[model samples]
Target: MSDTGSYNAVTWLLDRNVDEGRASKLAFTDTVSELTYGDLQKQSRRVANMLRRLGVRREERVAMIMLDTTDFPAVFLGAIRAGIVPVPLNTLLTSDQYAYVLADCRARVLFISEALLPVVKDMVGRLSDLDHVVVCGNDAHGFKKLSDELAGESDSFVTVPTHADEPAFWLYSSGSTGMPKGVRHLHSNLAATAETYASQVLGIREDDVCLSAAKLFFAYGLGNALTFPMSVGATTVLNSERPTPATMFALMNKYNPSIFFGVPTLFSAMLHDEALKHERGGTRLRICTSAGEALPESVGNAWKARFGVDILDGVGSTELLHIFLSNSPDDIKYGTSGRPVPGYKVRLVNEAGAEVSDGEVGELLVDAPSAGEGYWNQRSKSRRTFEGHWTRTGDKYVRDAEGRYTFCGRSDDMFKVSGIWVSPFEVESALITHPAVLEAAVVPEADPEGLLKPKAFVVLRADAKTQGLQEALKEHVQQKIGVWKYPRWIEVVDALPKTATGKIQRFKLRDGAR
Candidate 1:
């Protein structure tokens, strides 16, 4: 290897932080521990040394099932430094789900947090390609102890020379409908995302500290909790638990972060949560961002009215890494997914593969430098999605005359009722506006003749889940939205099923388990 040949994504981020005089700056924090840029850089190098000592080769995948804790980024950055492709698995998933991904990726080493190791360790027996398991918490439980081993390793390691186009990391899709697909990203995508979205759109500053309701594993959370903040040498708050409204507010109070990233469901919960209503004094949040699911207009408006903060919602996918079409601070529309960011090009394409005009709904396509290489082991699906210079987002949207895009629903999720098209997101947004409604999901249910009609699976307020609430909710939708688009059937459940990132599983509702 040449003395100075390549730009490693990991070392570049660390060097940028050091060069900007942020060596002693707070880089990551949690309930139990905090780490600075100097600490992170040193620990990440030690992790790389540990991996090399374990005989892990360049470009080999190191899969992790970890929380949004201090160890997540250190190990992730270490993989990037060593030119190892890091595969961050969703922390909350069934053993079968973990088995599917671990088997698919054939990851050489598996690093699991301590709390989860007991349940997941048995699966290692079935994984023929897995060579070792390294636990991330205090005690390793007979497996390799990650923190203990790093303590003995040297804190100096040379960054592997990887080309710009080579694979750097892989984020598995949320798999709300089916098995997860790995979205592979190149080495250059991370830096480009920081330059375009974080710099131009969000205007992130070095003084800004970020807290994300989305975990570190999801694409949105990874950018918010790690890449975006670290790009400007900013600090990030890490929470290890699931992103309940209670947990989020606690982090906000503890960290007083300037930026809070969340999904629509959490925003909805916080708006109606009794505990948070009385305590909204000093979060110091300048602006809030929402993604992973479309932020319902009702939820967005309620959040602003309740908390005095505007939530800028946007559209992004695992393939694009982060938000490409987003609502900026100065140009936020409560109901629209704002215009494209500086370095991204957007297209609304119809079924004929032609661009749709303003006021017409079509599938959304985004072309960005931060786009992923392709899905792993799925050639045909990759060909359909990862076209040259563009990625099909699979969500349908309508563009306004001013170039603002309103999210309709997933292209596959859109249904027809009596020869007219119906967007579940539109109806779901309307359903959520009802006073008694807390959360909602709309899907198509078929009859004997195979004709489909809109059906709603709802989670009502504690007192409103009583008898006859279904008919009232149906009428509420009829009044709020189009009469024909109202749900023909309604079922009230205790909670809506969601992915680890809080995206509603509408497909589960379609299967009639509710």
Candidate 2:
């Protein structure tokens, strides 16, 4: 199991699939099309050859602004095959947001879907390093159509010989604190992530059909949908749009996938699904995993009761590439973000970098197999995060007596209310425990008295109303945890703000709280 530089994930899959005569075992399927591993390699090589023809060199940035589609995997793996670093951008972001990523990464070329041409066109003059814009369906100004370009190209490519430390791709942070920064992953980083998370933590089976609600632009989604299943020779479903509960449920029925990956927000939505109760379960999903944020125990228990499945959650950051610590099927703990995966170490430390006692909250630091090289261009942030080698995830956590890690909240998310530290998750979880509450987000806001107090925004049950529910929910927290932790004010909202991967955007809530 010695790590080597030549071991890249794509190459490993190509060799295994080809060797085992499972090259055509159908790696990717969507409503529109299906691609086997053989088809994946073919399209990947075609895109790689096309990139080489377009003069994409080693270490160049190839940006993709597209929804989750069949072509995404082709271009993504193709860029890596050609030794270019693929930077997948969220199609849902504004042109200005996309412009920031292009400028920050100095992306040389961008491959965008025609659906997003309007957005990309707005930033054309602003991007200095951008040389080409390859549109997926139709041609634009000085841009080639992906379909036309690949139509005549040969389906063969040479895998680039990359060092273990060589950058393979640059995925961006969620931009909760500021504009998203690019987190760079090396070639072996993908391989290591596939081996560590998929093999050890996920334990994905060859027969398992995997599906992810998170899009490819985000690291967690990309790993679950593309890298993990491909590395393990499993099948995956690629939904070409954002998934609503209904959409996801329909797809589950259509594909009958056994393993599902989603965020806590999505899981909560499914728990409220009336369709689940009426239709019973369509597909017998063996396992479901949650990431992007801590899964409230209330949500987990609700989903399990409704669907006969446990929503095992894990803690991960774009910086660490994927989930480094997660709960497996055998070791399911109801409330904790499980133990560290194989080849990784977890330590909870105080401000001075000293380890905290068990059950005490501290900043979480991870020593993982797939730690990114550093931020793409931010050396200062890089220095701040990388201690010797391990990346500081900036998340706060506690390890209990049983060695299970309980996620407290983000380090930056810990806010002071009346001179005391408060973890929003702790308060939010307490609020959701009320039967009338569907979901809740806690933020610190100043009261009329000028003292900061915890404020809660909640999504009530369909039969519940905001008028009486707010005061009761506030008192419920006081009765459960303490009177000090009770939210001074409560607002019932239809929904909460979330990132692309469905993590609560705490800073947004904090803005309104202020």
Candidate 3:
């Protein structure tokens, strides 16, 4: 591999304002705990020293099971500085799910936070390769305290020289079908993703205050919160708990940030909050972004109308470790995801790997430096996902004449209904366009006549679940997309099952439809 003329992930972040000797520049929550660039450098070096002392070697996997807090970046960058790969585990995973990932990644050093200690203890026996369990808390059983180890260590450590192809982090694929697979990403790939997603697409500035609704474990959230902000000299606001609409609103009011990164579900809920709408337009919010799933056109319009700001939607995957295509703030379209980011090549291809005609639906393939090296420990699946330097994102999309990409749905979510192929995302998008529907998921349901008909699971916008509204919504779909695509059955559900990253779990809708 040739040199990309770039520093690895750790050096790239540390070089920003390291000469100034300031770490916490601004006050956080009216407290002095805010981290500055200089503080980041010192903590990262100390974490690197701690990892090296704990016998962590280059390319060895260290699993982190913690919430989004100040320690996350220190530990993550420290591992990178020490030339070790950090595998962040999803906090929401059950004992079995956590055990499987730990066993599969073969992580020798497992770090746990106090909040997640109970589940970590349940899987401790199942993880045979795990030699250490460092807890970010007070005295804990069967674990070393993380706070005591990094107290007085000198902030002077040398970064190990690592090849560009050396593993930097291991992200797991979102397992919609079965168990998730480990994805190995090189340091070069992470750096490339930071440049493309933060520089080209987000155009994030150093003075920007960034806060993300997605968690730290998800790839989208990881890039948006940590990597993207660090690429520039931006401050990231991390909330360790789950982000409810109330929590997000209070944070925005308190922090007064410029950028808010979230999924469509979060955006839609924010639009409905009267308190948020009343105070948002008076604020200085520069841009809002939606990703990890398609943003409904109605949600985009609703947010824009309320805040006088457009919500730029994008598409990305864990396999790629960052966003592939996104709508920039200056050139955003309400409904469509904009063209691919600079330095990335995107194409819609058919089953034979040939380019599809314009306006034709096919799998979205991306040729970017950000794509993962391959799936860890699964060579066959790796071959299928990574082809000839391009990563095949398993999403079906259409390219318009202007080169804008319109997401149809996941390739697996597109199924035949009455001999016509239907995209669940498209149907759900249409259903939400109706005024009464707050959220919706479309799936194939078998009719009494043994035919698969489109079914919609909907959550009413308000307490307006009157009989008049349901019939009007069914008619609205018929008028908008035509009779063939209309959902034959509509179920008013209170809530939809969602992934930890805020993606709607269509598999649950499919099962409920059946």
Candidate 4:
């Protein structure tokens, strides 16, 4: 845990909010309550005292399964103050998925809210390493009540003196291709992203109120909802409910946040929402960021046309923490991911590990201080993913001479459609441009000739899914982007399967589930 290359980020992230005289400023707000910077610090300290009293030691994993509320950040920051590694779990997971993460992390203690207590109890017996369950809202059965315990504790615990390289937290990857894997992150990682992307690129300030459609468990949301905001003493708007088009619109209208973060899927849903059609302009968002996947240029343009704000398409992974490459407000490339952020380096490498030419598609490798401590417990996967200081992002991209990047697809997402290689993103991007299509996901289906043919599952605009809409979509793709790039099969669906972070799960389509 003593691999120190940077400063203690818990101090760097939160303590400075106090020192900078933002103590009275609102730190976070949700349906339940609001907390100022002083209130957050006070609550976090109490949480730290409770953990220390319960014998939770330095670097021990303390898992939390709660919705996005004020208490979520309290317990999160509290665990870090005590030098415990807090593991925030995806709330939209099944019992088996919860069991795997609880046992895999060897989490000694788990904090669950009253709403999800039943689900946690169902799999509690399977977690051999879990010694205690600190219920957040109500009776704990045989476990302890976290609220009551914190109520008695003094809010004056000292922050632990942990080095920057010490593991501070864990976020499971958004298992798009397979089972989710735990990703270990250092205390310094948050600072790296805040300084480079949040500070240099987004220019978040103390007055900015940040709201993210993506939940906090995922890596992208962690930055948009907490780390990035906390670093600059900015306020964040949180919502306990799931992020639907309605919920996001309500949050934006209610909070009037200056900076808004959302994924492409939700953005498309907002575009198709009848209620939003009557709304005039962007609520209060001056800066809007899109990640979790490569956003289609068509969606970005549509949003810009309606809301009068540009969506900065960026790329990052669990392995690299948050966005290492992105487009800035001043340099919005409509169809391309912008240059690397200030604190990161990027290279496109070919199969033989040689740097590819600018226009050629190659695997993207990124180097940044925000990079994680490799995959948890999987030594072989860790070695392959973390190459020295660089992370093998497993994404293919093409860079132009101007240093702009265009995401091709996941290396595994490309296949031969008819004796020719095709990228699903290329076709899906084109499919979304059609007037009737709201969102599209393309997957390779095995054809009679043994070639992997492209098949599209599309969500059409409301009231646009007529009997002959499928044929229209196919014709549109053929006419706009090359005919060879068109999907051989098209199915109109109400929605596409997505991860907790709003990333389309293409693997499920490949497995014949969608």
Candidate 5:
């Protein structure tokens, strides 16, 4: 595990499990099938052999458009085992976005799931650098079948002696601001997150079972379902279908997982279900974690009251690969993102690059061991985000006297009202606390005098009356936080715009406000 010696992330994640007598342990279970640690290692080796057979060289990129199945881990780790870089794309993106990423990474091979072929089926053979297409299911539609390709290859290959600092994989950002940018992470970065956040905060053990509603395409889910569980040979439950309140509850009741990873949006929806009010049998969730967005204090408290388990709210970004500031089991704060994680440092700075005092909003910058190298094909942006060892998180936060950081809003989402800065998250948090509100988003709109004021977009509960709801919500917000921070205009909608990872796209709302 030394940085100076030969190292491969797959060697530590996949091979180490087999070497330590966990070969027969259940590694992954999907809706259709299951894979053991022994089978995962062997299949990964076969995948390495198949990639080499297809003229894919070391350091070359392979794009993965597969779903949350057992094949995902094998292909991902196999590429790392053969010293090839794998780029896992968000399956929910449009065909144009898929084309942009496939062409951007210049991936030599594309491994896609059968059901998702329609998204990029027309783009096949159109990308300049893409040479081969391999489908992971039965109907290949004239493309190479993954099972057929693996049948001809041997399940024995040597682990490439890659350097610890070598580029292992690429994760494209969710494009909350604009187009997606590829973030490069090293071989050591995977293990760094496991050792710090996974080991210290989650305290994952060998006997634990994990089920993350987040998918593998996301950085949060990649660590939660793949690296974290694999780091200790724990069992992981994978669901390919969309995660709803019913689906997630069914999986939890069936698997009896000890740990669950989810975002704030899903947690809020699950809390609204009447089924959650009744006691479900065989639910053994010991610890639950929330990321991708801040967990509302009311939602967290309500969840703990309904089911005697806390949702550890934390803050992380694609640039950092995983969470660097999180609430642990011992220290439970409902609203604030807990103190800096072990082996990481965080600071808040103003526009002039000076450190901000407590109770003042500033950008949150992190210096972590798992920080990404930089954005691919983006020099100016790379320099702007990755400054020496510090990576700007693009989030505005205020630190309390006790050193807990509370999220304000994104730097771009913050605006001034009455010459005072207004945090959209703070206002949105206040709005969602009302009885009629299900979800809320705040954006700044110019008033008649060309002055900016808060405008809110809200989704109401199923049975709530909307006749006088706006006035009721306005008065409720004024009483909760402050009178000046209430939204000047409120519009109830069916849903809010969000990224594939469940992050609200406030910039889109800003455009509509204009």
Candidate 6:
């Protein structure tokens, strides 16, 4: 796994699995079909041959709007095997976002699932760079069917000799604050994450089974269900439908997955789900991880008490690929994000570009081995985010004397009230500790005097009464954290706006406040 020299990620992730006598092992099981390690390699090779037959030259981009099925891994790895870059788009985005990304990356081919064809079917002809539209499932709708195309191709195409530093894939930012940016990742970056976080932190083994509630399009999910499992020839479970508590519990009971990956929102929802209360501890889940947002201490502790397993609440971004700072199973910290993984380094710095001391909040910067190369077209942004080896995470955090980091808020989400900075995450965490609150988002709102104060938007539990709940929640936060951090106003909402990855869109809330 050297940084230099010729290396194709597919060689290590797919080919080696078969070469080591794991060809017959179940590599992936989707809702519809199962893929063995033998079948995955063969199908990926066929995909490489089909793309070449369709005149998709080396290094050209291919956009994937498919779900969390077996087809996703075959296409994703196949493109990289053939030296083509695959851009996995979020399936939940609007048609305009798909068109923008297609045009932005100038994707030559689009491999969309049959279920998602209607989302961008009308705009297919409008994309000038798009040469082919291959549907993954049935009903091609006058377009090319992927199964038919692969049928005529050979399953033994030689993998293209690609450099470790060459671009292999692209993941768009979840765009919590603004438009999604194309984050280009190199071939070496994939193994770097597997070796650092997956191997060291997760301690993934070949016999383990994995299930990730996060979709394959997300960075966290991509690592959880695809790379980490594939790195050790482990099996993974994939579900196409939305991840509700019922659906997640059903999968756990059926598959008995050894590792489960989820976000904070899903964990909170599952905790409140009464119907599935008897299904707890039914799975073989030895390790659970959370990302996409900070896991509240209350939610983490309750989950552990019920499931008899600790949730390793970590933080990761699309820019760095996967989690660099995470809590390990041995060292469990309920409130703070755990120390950095063995291979990664983290630092918190102030506005003056100086490192902050313990207990002082500052923006976090990470020097990760898996850091992306740069944004696809935005040069200024790439320069700002990736400075030499250090990448700015744009997350505000405070380090304790013992070296654990606690999430404060995003850099733009933090605001000063009465000349003191107030963290939206801190207030939101406090609000969630209340028994009546299911989820909460805190944003700064201007008062009558033109001063900013914490304003909360909360989603109450199903059985909780709304009468006198706002004041109760305010007092609860005031007592838990401090009086100065209490929300000035509270709005009971059915749901908060979130990105595809389950991160609350706080900026959208701030926009409405104005």
Q: What lDDT, from 0 to 1, does candidate 2 have?
A: 0.83
Model 4, residue 85: C-alpha shift (Å): 0.4
lDDT tens digits, residues 332-377, model 6?
8988899999899999999999999999999999999999999989
**Considering only N, C-alpha and C atoms within 3 Å, which residue pairs clash in candidate 6?**
none
Candidates' lDDT values, in order? 0.86, 0.83, 0.81, 0.86, 0.93, 0.93
- Per-model RMSD to reference: 2.2, 2.0, 2.2, 2.1, 1.0, 1.0
Worst 10 residues of 4 by lDDT: 1-10
| Worst window of 10 by summed lDDT in candidate 5 | 274-283
lDDT of 3 by residue, 164-198 (tens): 87788988866756788998888887678777778
lDDT tens string, model 4, 306-403? Answer: 88888988988887889988999999987788999988999999889999998888899998889999889899999999999889999999999999
Candidate 3: Cα lDDT at 69: 81
Query: Which window of 10 residues has the lowest lDDT sum in candidate 3?
Result: 24-33
- lDDT tens per residue, model 2, 1-514: 3355464556775557767888879888878888888888889888988888888888888888977888899899888888888999877777778888888888888888887898778667667888888887646556788888888889877788766677888888878667888888877777788888888778888888998998888888888898888787889899986788888888988888888899988887776776665544356688888998899888888778877877779988888889988898889887789999888998988998899999788898999878888887789999999877678988988888988998878886787776767888989899888988888888888888877788889888887755677678878998988889899888888889887777788788888877
Off by over 4 Å in 5: 275-281
Clashing residue pairs found in predicted model 1: none
> Residue-wise lDDT of candidate 1 within 177-240, one digit each (tens)?
8889999998888888889888998889999989988888888888899999998899999988
Error of 5 at 454 (Å): 0.7
Q: Candidate 6 — worst ten consecutive residues by lDDT sum?
A: 276-285
- TM-score list, all predictions: 0.96, 0.95, 0.95, 0.95, 0.99, 0.99
Q: After superposition, how far is residue 471 of candidate 4 from its true place, in Å?
A: 3.9
Q: Give the count of colliding residue pairs in each prediction.
A: 0, 0, 3, 0, 0, 0
Report the backbone clash tally of model 1.
0
